[model samples]
Target chain A: MDLFIAIFTGTIIAATPLIFAALGELVVEKSGVLNLGIEGMMLVGAAVGVWVSYAGLPMPLAIMSAAAAGALASLLFGVLALTFLTNQYAAGLSLAIFGTGVSAFIGKGFGSAPLDALIPLEIPFLTEIPVIGPLFFNYDPLVYFSFIMFGLISWFLYKTKAGLVVRTIGESPESSHAIGYPVIKIRYLAVMFGGAMAGLGGAYLSLAYTPLWVENMTAGKGWISLALVVFAAWRPARVLFGAWLFGSMTIFQLQGQALGISLPSEVLSSLPYIATIVVLVIISRNWQFLALNFPTSLAKPFRPAE
Target chain B: MRFQIERRVEPSSFMRFAAPVYATFSTLVVGSIMFALLGHNPADTLFAFFITPLMTINGISEWLLKASPLILIGCGLAIGFRANVWNIGAEGQLVIGAVCASGVGLFYPDPESALLLPLMVIAGMAGGMAWAAIPAFLRARMNTNEILVTLMMTYIATLLLSLLVHGPWRDPDGYNYPQTALLPDAALFELFDPMYRLNTSIFITIVAVFAMWFFTERSFFGYKMSVGGAAPLAARYAGFKQSGSIWMGLLISGGVAGIAGMAEAAGPLGQLSAQISPGYGFAAIIVAFIGRLHAVGIVLGGLLLSLLYLGGEAVQLSLGLPSALTSIFQGMLLFFLLASDFLIFYRFTPFPKPIKSGVT
Candidate 1:
């Protein structure tokens, strides 16, 4: 029972960053842009978040600075994909390379420094419960924020007028433009939002989860978040489930070792990536399911006709 | 006033050549500003980046040594890129290739046999192809996105390589180092010059360039693949199979990249280590684009990019600049090149007669 509660707690903590990033990407994709640079953006966020935190700023301010840095990095992609009309695939890739390089350069001196980790919240009423309290009520603020974000994103995507506009643009940018919606502006906003969320995810790693800075520290969590967005079929509610599934896979190695499973640590470490590929294959194998869920204008550059 | 972009009826051939040059010039200008901000002499930094790397004969040899794998991999990537098949997992393929080639070199019964080198090359190519075949099959059968699949496979490959080096392939005499034993003399490539690292592996790259040129420029199959890329519907109408292009494109690139991996293992490395490459596979993607997905262009692009790698090291030694600056410059060059590519299909002009704007 103790092990079960511990695993559940670890899973939720692990899933927080993915939740933030995948939700952001879901919104960006809903607005018809495929930003493959999430990994890069998260990396920049992690580095900047750690740098600021090491400078003795408040934790919230450090996280916010990370988000701003991510947004600024993503604007570089916006200029290329939205304004200059470069190939989004290539543009996103270059943005990722740019982010990795810039983050490494800026974070060189800060890599060895550690930041104060975010403390787990202790709700007064919930603290009396045994297993449930430890599993649910004892996580850091980011975990709660991630849960709230899922509900908010679901509401914004399906219930709001602005959400409808974003989805309509994703389905057919030309029609959206013809109906007088500012497609480019909306997409730019979505891209920036996605960037901010990816940044927040990065901050969660350095300021909350690991509490230390390392080169390329996000370590492909950004890519897993991308896979999570797909696994969820671009739905916010499903994203929560998918993020938990992947996050559990990440922690399973540690849990397995505790349970006396004797596999090599490297093989165990590879489980999440292998699981991602397998899930991707299973999801993509059904052509109709994929066709129905995938955004029609995803990865297509929208250049309004004059 | 303001500038408006206008579509060109036909792409300007002059701009086709001029865009890369313009991007190079702008990157230099931007790079100088970056260096000045870093408290270094801009001119000296730029010189170190571009010219200082090739000042000595040994330097030129080292440049070519690094460029060989990049050119080999870039040529393969160029073929796939031309057909719009994104196989960004060349890094994984390269790693697998090295693993297989080293497996042969380390365990082969007759290490001194003349056939050892050829066998290693074949095994390496086969290993790379086997790794790439996963994504090819997935994309062809399941309609999966190749970009994500390939990238995911790279992470898996890195882990697999680490597992092998740390466990089964660890050197016995050496104290817990994560690497294989040194390959035998017969497994190594012959040196072109004893004074430098230049080896016979470059001859393979030269031959590959010629083959790539002929295939892409003159072959009917290449023409079909290009049609498949440019107009998918038209290609379907013309009876060109999409699966054919995907398979051939991936296989060719995988095979070439595998051979390059074998060259690195048998040439300068002489053994398999956990870090056989410093992201040569990813850098090759930049080389493919800078060369405009053309065979001859890849040769030049490979040289230029290889020079950048060497120059980055030189600057680190001389100016005390962070080595990460190389990647920054490389990324900036690609960004500028992509931005300038707009000139291929559109021209910027002064906004004519502020007219009402609406969807046409």
Candidate 2:
């Protein structure tokens, strides 16, 4: 039971960053722009967040700084795709490369440096509940924050007029333009929103999960988030489930290794990524489903005719 | 005075041919600004990064050694990309190839069998093709997004590689480091002089480039791929099975990438290890694009990118710069290239009067 609690705790912490990132991407894709630079942005955010925290800033401030850094990096992507009418794929890839370099350069002095771990808050009566208490009530602030963001994003995407406009832009930018909506500006905002979320997710990794900065520490989580967006069929509720699923796989591999399971540690270590691919293959197996589900103008550059 | 707006004329062929040179020069100018911002000596850093690395014997060999995989992988990728069939999982294919070849190489650990080397290379090619076929299969049968599929496969390959190195492939004699024992000399191929640290994989790379040129320029299949990329609808109407192009593109490219992987494991690293590639598969994507997906052009891009890799390392050692500076430069170059590509296709115009007053 103790081991189960520990494993459950670790899984929530591990899944928090992924949840944050995938949720961010979910919103971005819901708005119809695919930002492959999520990895780069998250990495930059991690570095910035770590560096700011190291400078003796408050942890909350440090988190915000990380989001700002991610937003700035993503804005560069927006300029390329939305303003310059460049290929989103190419622009996204470039941002990834650029963000990686910039973050690595800035983060040189900070690798593996220790910081304060995020402390978990225990609810009084709920904390005493057998299995449910530990699982739901006791977790770092970030874990709870991810769920809040999930709910808020789900509401904003489904229940708001602005959300509908954003969806319209994603579905058909030209028509949105015809309807007097600012397609580019909406996408730009959506991209930045996604970037901020990705950055916070990265900050969670450095400041909470690993509790230290490392070069390229995001380690393809951003890409996994992109895949998660697809896996969830671009829905917010699905994003949470997908993130938890991946989080379980990540923790399961480590737990298996610790328990002296027969499988190779390396294979187990690689299981999350392998699981990501397997899930992608499974979800993408139905081309008709993907085609029917995808936002029609998701990655298409939007240019208002002069 | 009225502003006269004449459409910009297409530059002459000579200027068109020299566009990359101009882009490179512009990139350098931008790079200089980056260096200045970092408070570094631009001239010294640029000279150290670009000129100093190529001026020494060891440096030259290192450059060639690194260039080998990029060239091989780039050649295959260029061919596939030209046909508009992206096989971005070359890294995965490369790892799989190395894994298969190494598997064969491991069983026959002694430096003895005459037929061992050729057999390993064949095994590598087969391994690469098999990995590449996954996305090809999905695209052909399910009409899945190959880009996402191929990209996702890369992570899977990285994990699988890690598993092998850490688990079953871990060297018994060595400490707990996740790596296998070095292959015996008999299993190794002599590509370059061992004394100088040069390997024979460089030669293989050169031959592959020329072969790629011939295949693309002369072969019937090559024409099919070109037509397919240029106009998929037209090609389909012409009865060219899209599936055939996908398979050929994935297989041939995977085979080349596999050989590159095999070469690195057999010729240099001589064992299966976790860090067999330092994002070479992803880097090759940049190489393929910079080369404009042309056979001969890919060779030039490969050499340039290899220089960037070497220079990045040199800067890290000499200037105390972070190793990621190389990735930054590569990313910047790609960003600039995409910008250039946009300018080539569409002319930018100033915003007209607002349809409605909501936009800022």
Which numbered prediction scores highest in DockQ against the true structure?
Answer: 1
What DockQ does every candidate get? 0.81, 0.65
C-alpha displacement of B332 in model 2, angstroms?
0.9
Which model scores highest in lDDT?
Answer: 1
Q: List the residue pairs that clash in candidate 1.
A: none
Q: What lDDT is reached at residue B80 by model 2?
A: 85
Per-model clash counts, in order, read 0, 6
The digit string of per-residue lDDT tens for model 1 on A1-306 reads: 988887888888888999999999999999999998888899899889888888899988898999999898889899889998899989888888888888889887774655688889889979669877887788888889988988998999999999999999999999999999999999999999999999999889888888888878887888888888888888888899998898898786769877677889888888888888899889987867767767899989989998
What is candidate 2's lDDT per residue for A188-283, written digit by digit as tens? 999999899999999999888888888888877888888888888888888888887888877766688566677755566667777777788788
Write one digit per residue (lDDT tens) for candidate 2, span B275-326.
Answer: 8887788788888888877777788888888999999999889887777878
Model 1: fraction of the reference interface contacts it also forms? 0.75
For residue B355, give model 1's deviation from the true position in Å.
Answer: 10
Range of the 10 consecutive residues with the lowest summed lDDT in candidate 1 chain A: A108-117
lDDT of 1 by residue, B92-196 (tens): 889989989999999999999999999999999998898888888988888777888888888888888899889999889768888888999999999988888
Docking class of 2: medium
